[model samples]
Structures are given as C-alpha cells and as structure tokens.
Target: MSGQNCWGYGGDNGPLNWHKQFPFAQGDRQSPIDIVSAQAVHDADLTPISISYSACTSLSICNSGHSVMVEFEDCGDKTVVSGGPLENPYKLKQFHFHWGQRGRQGSEHTVDGKSYPGELHLVHWNSTKYNTFGEAAVSHDGLAVVAVFLETGDKHANLHRLTDALYMVKFKETKAQFKDFDPQCLLPKCRDYWTYPGSLTTPPLHESVTWIVFKEPILVSEKQMDKFRMLLFSGEEDSEKQPMVDNFRPPQPLKGRTVLASFKL
Candidate 1:
C-alpha cells in the first residue's frame, strides 16, 4: 500500500482505485482541478511571481515507474521561487512531466475544459519554514508547484535536451546523471497564472501544494512528445512492458476552494 509499484494509471490500480490504498486520494483540496476561467477571481493584491533557477544545480534524471523527473541540488537558497500567493520563498527540488499517448489529452489540469498535450511540474519546497523537503511535504503550504501546459506546435529548442536523454532511463527505477540543465528555459514567456490550494497529483496525495498554473502553454512538436511516450512504466526485469503514456491524473473536484487569477479575466 505504500510502495511505488502499488499504484499506477491503469484500470486495475488507476486514480479510481487509488482511494482504496491511500485515503487522502478522496480528500478535499486535491490537485489538477479543471480551471474554469470565468470562475477564477482576479486578485489585484496578488503580486507577480519571482523565480531564480539560473543558479540551480541539476543533479540527475530518473524514471520512477510513473514519470521522468529531473532532480536538483537544493542545499541552499540558490534556486528558489517566491511571491504570487506564497508567503515565503521555496527551494527548487525537482521537475517532471505528465503526458498522454496523443497530442490533445495529456494535461492534468485543463483550462475551460480544454486539455493540452502535456504538463510540466516544477516542484519546490518551503525551505524557509521547513528544514527538509520531506518535512515540508505533509504540512499545509509546504509545497509550491508551477504547472505549465504544453501544446503541439513548433519544436521547442530547450526540451530536446531532456528528451534526448530519455533513452538512458527508459525503464522504471532507472536513473542517469543529468547536469546543468536550467528549468527556466522550459517556461512560457507569459507570467499570468491562476493560484489555488491543492494536493499532490500522485500517491500519498498530500494536501500541501500551492498550485500556480500558467495561462499560456509552451509549444513542442508532436515528434518531441513522442519521445516521452517511448518511456516504459515497467522495470527492465518485469515480464510485461507498459508504455508510460497517459500518466496524468484526471482533474479532481474543486469542492468550495477558490481559484485566484493573477490577471484580469
């Protein structure tokens, strides 16, 4: 019930069955909620977000039987994201992608019921208040996830670097050294976003994430996205190989939560 292999996006152990193992899966404040653009209230008091990932150290990339993630060195305040609903600056920990088999159904969080080809999650922890990422993850306001939607269009110049390294960690639980890649390059030009209180989209489903979902999506060609699909959800020793496509969790209920927009509707 606690191991990584116990849960997945398949019909047998998918989001629908996650609640059986992890009770928090059914909790309020869950993540990847459908963003009804008209319902988001513009908050003038909300300041623009500040990001400083230029000095961040990229450590490694791995496949965790779910998604391919790039870990970062967060020993100090070198890489941090602040402002825009966050009370204190959070340290960058890692970044990952959630995608689907096709070009139009990958994104976890949708805009006005519209889904994108994929989504990028730049995860940060409340280092200012908590000593470790683990200590912060279960607490309220302990994590900040910047979510950017990915659309199928022209080839993204920066994404190829990460996609090219996918072959090394094509199987689950495998990792390889990946250094010096700046996540700032993956973000879209527009800074406008919607902020909300939510939980982790994956297992454990901690209600600790302050979600900042961007309005604009970054463009990557369909071919580039296919590289992500090439990844497998099974281990090298496993009998059956499952393609790592449609790894994203569907949008959860909003309940009574308020979603605030940084700009005027």
Candidate 2:
C-alpha cells in the first residue's frame, strides 16, 4: 500500500479505516502520540541538534490533497540536520503543515494532553545510507522528522510568505513555484526537544521516523491561521467542494516506548 491515496480525514476513509488499506497504521510504533512530559526521561547524552538550511534550494509548494508542502532540492548536503539523536546528517527533503479550523485543536503530538493550533513537520532523509527519500522512508533509521507546534499569538511574518502563496495551490494536486524560501525562518527561538522512535502520522504510516518534537512553539495570529483554512481538499473539477480543515491525525498510544527529553524539566 505504498503511495496509496485513497485515505482521507473524513467519515469512511478517515484514520479509523486507514488500517484496512495500510496495515502499518496499527503498528507498534505509530506516531502523533500524546507526550506526557512528566514521563519523558532526560538524556544528558542527547546533544543539541545542528541545522544548516541557509543554503537550502527550495523548489516548489504543493497541496497534496492532505496538506500544504514545500519541496526542496536534496541532491546534495547543502541543507541538513545532524547531531542530537541522529548518527548521520539527514538531508532536508521537504516541509509541510497540519492545521485545524479553530485555534486550539490541530497539532498531532500533544504535551500533557494539551493540543496546539497547528504543527509543522520538517522531513529529512538519511542520504548517507539511502540513495533516495523513498528508499529511506521505510528503513529503521533512515528518516528524521523535526516537529514544531504552532501557537496563536502574534502574527508570524515569515509564515505569511507561505500563507500568501497558499492561494495558488488551493486545490488538490496543485503546485506553484516557491524557490529560495528558507525554512529556517519558521523555527522557534528555542531548540530544546523530545526524541523518540515513531512512524509517519500519515499513510503508509512507515515505522521509520526518529521523532524530534520541540519544546517551544512559534507564534502565529488567528488571521494568519485562517489563510491555511482557505485551502480546499477537492480538486478543481470535483462537484463537491470540501474545505480543508482538521487535517491532523489524533495522538496514538505511547505503548511503553520511552520519550527522551533534551532538557530537564
């Protein structure tokens, strides 16, 4: 069921029914788990992560019928994330977002049972071990995703550049040229995070991601968030127009897996 697109976030084809098409949905290391901060073990060995994205070559932005994604040129090590829990430098493949209609309920991973308005996933592949992103996506230690929670507060100036372009790819399968947009600007001031072994929040739900969820959230205003909701799930030809909202997968069970914190609480 690799690359399958039949699933959605609605009645019959939603997350609850994803296991039927992609069995990995029921895997032991599935993602978007509720992060109980008190239970997370602080690992002193966990060093601060290093990110080099200034030289990133962003190609385009697209609406993949599920979320908004910005693709990058990952042919070289110009942009990469290393250190932390990762043994090798992972090249940045792409970055995307998951959001909700309202301001309080969109993030995939929750902290102490608290949900944020949105979440940002910076996906990277182990270019050293795997030839391509597809090859690395299924391997045990081939992918690393840096998750950042989005909170509602002041308007994020950098985010507006993305929201402004969302109108171009308002329909499913639509894409627009989005070059040289540095994703580094979207990150928060704090880099403290929690690390764990988990799977993709979306299908095919490969249990391959080394999750690095940040401790602090970047602020964006309600107006800025409303721009994301302006996107549509339906294609240009579809008779029914469904507004793209609540595109997040709910938190899964921790299943006794340990969550390691980079900083002590």
- Candidate 1 lDDT over 110-173, as tens digits, reads 9989999999999999999998888899999899999999999999999999999999999999
Candidate 1 Cα deviation (angstroms), residue 98: 0.3
Give each model's clash number: 0, 0
Candidate 1, which ten residues in sequence have the lowest lDDT sum?
A: 1-10
- The candidate scoring highest on lDDT is 1
Candidate lDDT scores, in order, read 0.91, 0.91
Model 1 RMSD, rounded to 1 decimal: 1.7
lDDT tens per residue, model 2, 24-124? 88889999899999999999999999999988999999988989899998658879999999999999989999899898899999999999999999999
- Let me know the TM-score candidate 1 reaches against the reference structure: 0.97
**Candidate 2 ranges with C-alpha deviation above 4 Å:** 1-4
